[model samples]
Target: MTLSAQLGIIVGYLVLALLIGLSAYRLTDRTAADFYLASRTLGTVVLLSTTFATLLSAFTFFAGPNIAYHEGPEWILVMGLMDGIIFAILWYVIGYKQWLLGQQYDYVTLGEMLGDRFGSGLLRGLIAAVSLLWLFPYVMLQQVGAGTALETLTDGAIPYWAGAGLITAFMILYVVLAGMRGIAWTDTLQGAFMLVVTWVAMLWLLTAIGGPTSATAALETEAAAHVALGSDHYTPQWMLSRALVIGFGVAMFPQVNQRFFAAGSRTVLKRSFALWPILCVLLFVPSFMIGAWAHGLDVTVPADGNVLPIVLTEFTPGWFAALVIAGAMAAMMSSSDSMLLSGSSYFTRDLYRPLAEFSSRDVSERREDLLARVGVVVFATAAFLVSLVNPATLFELGDAAFSGFAQLALPVLAALYWRRTTRAGIGAGILLSQTFYLLSHFTTVVPGTYAGWTAGVVGMALGLGATVGVSLVTTPAAAERRALYFDGNETGAE
Candidate 1:
């Protein structure tokens, strides 16, 4: 297809997304809860599809395939097979607990839940701050993915920054028009769209190469190392640590965690997680296979680009290929819009509300509402600037962010289930584990691994140890605040 035709398809998709997102403006009420959690009323289909779309992002569409392209299909084990199951189990373990307590307490954000549990606003502020800090890269990654996909597909006529900035602007407007409701509704469309495109693209590529049998035969000759199951890059430690990082880390995402509060019922929540693994398998396998096929075809991808678009354009016809790449852009938009909306809630609920109360300032719901919208704009713009810098590859950037978020998982789990958990214990765990994890980023002198454990494993281990050991020695914050999470209003909730 001509560049104009491709741009038309891409631009038309972007406008459709914005229009769909904005259509929710009338349905959304003018309250913080409505804006943040869609008034806590997401049913199974919307919840399942939105969560599935929100979690995959540019990371899954681009980095996932890129890994299989360069390394091998063994990268499949890194994601769908392990991560899908692990994350689904966590949704039940952690999410169900949050939903149960959230009903009684009406908690809006994770930081609020944890802080109220431990009776420490300081911890709440710290948690919100850390979440925003890590969320920057993950948010920026969507822009990176969009930039790469469009730039590659259009042969740079769109330019990397143009694609990055276009998605940024679209997301900011979408979040402002409607918050959780808009994002979730649009996510259902995008989720289904991306899945169909991915599978069709994969099947088309396979058939174009003369069926799966012939494609496998070609791969064996051209990429012998990638054809087999094992890759030296995937050590047991790497696999285990990665699973933990993605499973626990993703649950802590402001976007995904916020979804916990949005579930209409325990059944909706349970069914969503139950279907999560099936969704993962449907998307991950085909996307990875498409990338592995690139090696068999001798496709040359740029250093910054991946195999998905390059291969799609090569194998599929002009209009179909354009739609496939646009579908990938939908993945970026679906994820980015959700992140901006959720990240804004973190700032307004956890930080700004508390600050206003502390200052003895009379703030209206209108003021908080405005602050939330402002938060969306600020996060979207900041992430766009970072995308221009192109600081790192999608995989590296996502992995670093995941590891940092995973540091919080252990402490969060302990606080929710362990009545013995104390303010000082979770506080120590958060500060110490995150402190060590951040140090490893700045200084290589801090060993990235010890005794076959990856840096993420070491960080989470520190958090778990500090939480359990310190809680054993410390006094509980209060029994009254802990009862909400305990069964039968037990006095031992302390």
Candidate 2:
């Protein structure tokens, strides 16, 4: 495959994506539901595809392979396998309930639901602000992955900044123009392409090395530490622990919550949850192979993270390579658009709207809409800028944010089921927990804060304690407390 031909195919795929977005524009453009939740009419197929697409992003495609290439097979084969199943089980247990509530409340975003549940303006704003802050680093990591892939695939013909700019421009136009419908519809197409290309790439690489048996043998000899399970630093316990974090944390991701809200109904959402683990197997396993294969073939590069793209370009023919590049871009764009929309929704519903005292008819409502649209551009631009300056792996930044949110999992669960949990306690606990988690992340001076998830656990523990203890000490407000906790009417108990 010549470079020109590869570029041509890539452009053709982009055009197809744009057409899908344009076609879905009318479906998503009309009202609040249409814009934010795809009119609450998404079926099972669309929900499944969009869910998988949202999960399989730059980190999964590029970074997972890179981890396998560098660390060993345990990181992907063992750890990743556990992650898929665990995530599915967690979703089955709690996710359906959230979906049911979302339908009952006509919820458009996670912050909206949380605000209603807590019955506090300040807590909602805090949660929204924290979500936005954490999301920026996650988005920045995605932009970095995409820019690196484009630059390396095109051999620096497109610089990192230029690559970031191109993707951001396309996403902004795609997301703002059609909203959730455009994002989901385009994701359906991209997710399909990426899955097909992944299998093709795997088969091609296997064939390139003669057969699976021979390839395994070759990898065992050449990259013994990386190819074999439990080799090097790959222990079963460590792998299982890592998998737990990844699996559980995925649910706590704000982007995934937004996806849950995007579904039309509980049935569609439940089906998507059940199917996502299988989708994870399809996308994540092959990426692991790409890494191990790259290692066996001795295809070393300056940046280990580029191993996936480098392998795609090396093992596959020109046209196939072009398709692979397009698939990678698809992954990047799918996740990016979801994050942009999720972050913007936080700005609109949680911060701006609440400050207006939940009134949709206020003068500030129009300004808030404008602010959200503007936020889409500003957030995307910040991501691009951060990627250009310091390139970090998507997986690392994602895990950091994941761990941060996982701390809130306890509080969220408590808030949902425990009526005795007071707003003051919930608010104070989150503040303490998140603060401890950050201090643990940034500074090593404090002992016992070194365990990454441990920080979240401790923080959440203290926060929960404070919430329960404080509520016991102080009397709950008669009107608001009863309305919020007793009747299960976070949306005014109608």
Candidate 3:
């Protein structure tokens, strides 16, 4: 595509997103609940689309292909098929219960629900802190992807810093203006666009480069190792551990977790999960093929592994390439907006509320909304600045983010299901799990094989053990509190 055409396509997509945000703002109620959770009023289509789009971040759009380009089709088994089922199952298990509690208590954030459940402000703060630690990197992944994609597509016409700043600016504007409602509206549109464009681009590329059969034959003869697993790098243990980490981590992402409350009804949530795997199949199969085909074609992969832009520019027509780039931009923005909104909500509702002098009841909803908008600016700016450093490839940064969040999976499950779970037990589990993950991640204390097992999985095992052992020794939460979450019966005291 000509530089002007590609830039125009991308700018048009952003304008559409901005318009959606403005429309949603007109419809918004301007209350904290409405801003954060869309006033619990998302139907099946928007609910499913927003959740699916949010999950399919820049990592999925860009990094999936990049990994498949280098690591072979095993990336499909690890994230595409396995994570599809894993995240779907978690949505059913965790999301259902969370929706029930959120509806009953009118809770806006996970921290509020957990803190009230355990009657501990410290636990709430810990959850918020840990979520941000992981979420920040994930947001940065989107910024990095945006910058790299723009730079590659435009051939240095647009600088990396400007590209990152552009995305960050749009993200802050839309999120601060329309909140979750705007995000959901834009995500639904962007998700459908991305799915369609991806399939189209894949088909076009496959046809132009012979066919899938030809591509497969080429891969078999030239890049045979890319078709199979069990290589030195993709060990069985490594694949399994990586899958587990992404599965668990994705389920508990703050942006994702809050979607549980946004569902209009149980049926909406259930229908979304039912359709999730099918959507995964459609989106990922083509992505893997495109990457693998590029390898067979002997395309000179860039330093950052941005093979999609290179492939499109070389093989496709100008219009088609522009459309594909716009689709990719949509994917990044959709994920970025949700992350910005969720991160701000965590900071405002979870972190700030507890530390503030005023009672939550005394605080006005308007002020809470304003604080969250301020947080949107603050968090998005930080992520944008980090993206300028080019810390790592999209896949590497995402791996770290997912691993950190996965450590919370066991503790969350214990708190939700096990009546014996105590405040101290949950607290200790989070601390120890995060500490172990950091140690294993940054240092050589954990061996290669164990590190391949992923710091999150190892930490989760230890954390789960600590949670169970400590809870066994400590007092359980009072029956009244337990009944509130488990038995659906409140004692009026809590």
Candidate 4:
């Protein structure tokens, strides 16, 4: 196929997405609840689809296969089996609780929920700041992946900036257009599109290479190190760290955490969690297998290039390859739009609204919604600018974002279950743990990982310990404040 024809396929996909976004806008009201939480109307299908698509980003589309291609297929253990189960359990433990509270209190963002419970505006702003800060890299990562993927597939016809900008522009439009309602619908479309394309690419590659049996034989004969697991990269320490970082960390991401509030009912949330592991295997198993098979072929891959794109172009037709590339873009776009939408909520509600009130200026819901939309555009532009830097590999940037968000998990857990958890305790936990995690990553003041401990593990341990110990020493929150979250008379009350 000609370059124009291949590009046309991608263009058509974008137009379809735009149409979806527009259609979703028709169903929406201008309220913050409608914009951010879809009016709490998500059913199991849309809830599961949106959550899955939002979490499956450039990291999964590119870095996942890239790892399996270079390392062994043991990545399946971390990303597929362990993360699938762990995140599902977290959904029930954290998400279900949040949903129950949200149903009664109409809580939208994690910061709002925590801040209200602790009766601390500073804590709300701080949590929101941390969320927005870590979200920037992950958002930039999607743009970087989109740009790099386009550059690779066109064999450099498309410059990196153009590709990155294209997606960023579209993502900003989607969030600003329809908000969560539109994004969720579009996410469902994108999720199914990418999942099928991945399976097709894997099957085609296996057919061209004779079969999985043949691929395995080739892997054993050549690149035998990767054919087997438990070597350099798949050490117990690294593997466990990946699972811990990805599983716990991902659940607390502003985007993913927002979904916890969006669930229409406990049944919808329950079904989504129940089916998540199957979705995990369906996506990760094929993606990682493609990478492992690519290792056996030892296909010539460019510097910092994704092997899946190279292998697809080699074995598949140009149009099919173009379609598959669009699939990768689907994953990136879905995740980016969610990030922008969620970040906007944090900014306007947790950050901007509080500052406005501090000045004795009340923010109306209409004004708040407008500010949130503005936040989306501004943040998208910022991410696009950062994407051009090429700071690190997809995995490195992703792992950093994951580890950063993981620090929130422990403090949040303490808040939900322990009524004795004080504002002082939670505040200390957030500050000290986040400070340590940042130092470990940015300054090398501390090692990012030691032995089997990723920065996230170290951070979470410190956070939990601080929360428990401080809560013991400090005064508990007022009795009335605790009743809203935990009534001793209520069954199953914390």
Which candidate number would show the highest lDDT if scored against the true structure? 4
Query: Which scores higher on lDDT, 1 or 4?
Result: 4
lDDT comparing candidate 2 with the true structure? 0.72
- For candidate 1, give the lDDT: 0.85
Better of 3 and 4 by TM-score: 4
RMSD of 2: 3.5
lDDT for predicted candidate 4 compared with the true structure: 0.88
Candidate 2 residue-wise lDDT at 216: 71
Report lDDT per candidate: 0.85, 0.72, 0.83, 0.88
Q: Candidate 3 lDDT, tens digit per residue, 152-248? A: 8787999989888888988888887878998999888988888898898899988887989998888777778887766777888788888888998
Over 4 Å off, model 1? 478-480, 489-494
By lDDT, the better pick of 1 and 3 is 1
Query: Cα deviation in Å at residue 479, candidate 2?
Result: 5.3
Q: What ordering of candidates by TM-score runs from best to worst?
A: 4, 1, 3, 2
The reply for model 4, stretches above 4 Å from the true place, is 477-480, 490-494
Please write out the lDDT profile of model 1 over residues 1-494, one tens digit for every residue. 79999889988997898888788878888887888889899999999989988887888888988888888877777787556788888898888888877888899999999988877788899999999989999989989999888888888888899989888988888888978898898889888898888888888888888898888778888878888777677677777778878888998988998898899998898778778778888888999988877877868988778788898888899889899878888878888888888888889889988999999998798888888888888888988997899979999889888988999999999888888888889989988889888888768867887766778779998999999999899888663265557877566545
Residue 436 error, candidate 3, Å:
1.0
lDDT, candidate 4, 119-234, per-residue tens: 88888999999999899899988998999888888989999999999999888888889789998998889988888999999899889999999999998887788766689768
Weakest 10 consecutive residues of candidate 4 by summed lDDT: 476-485
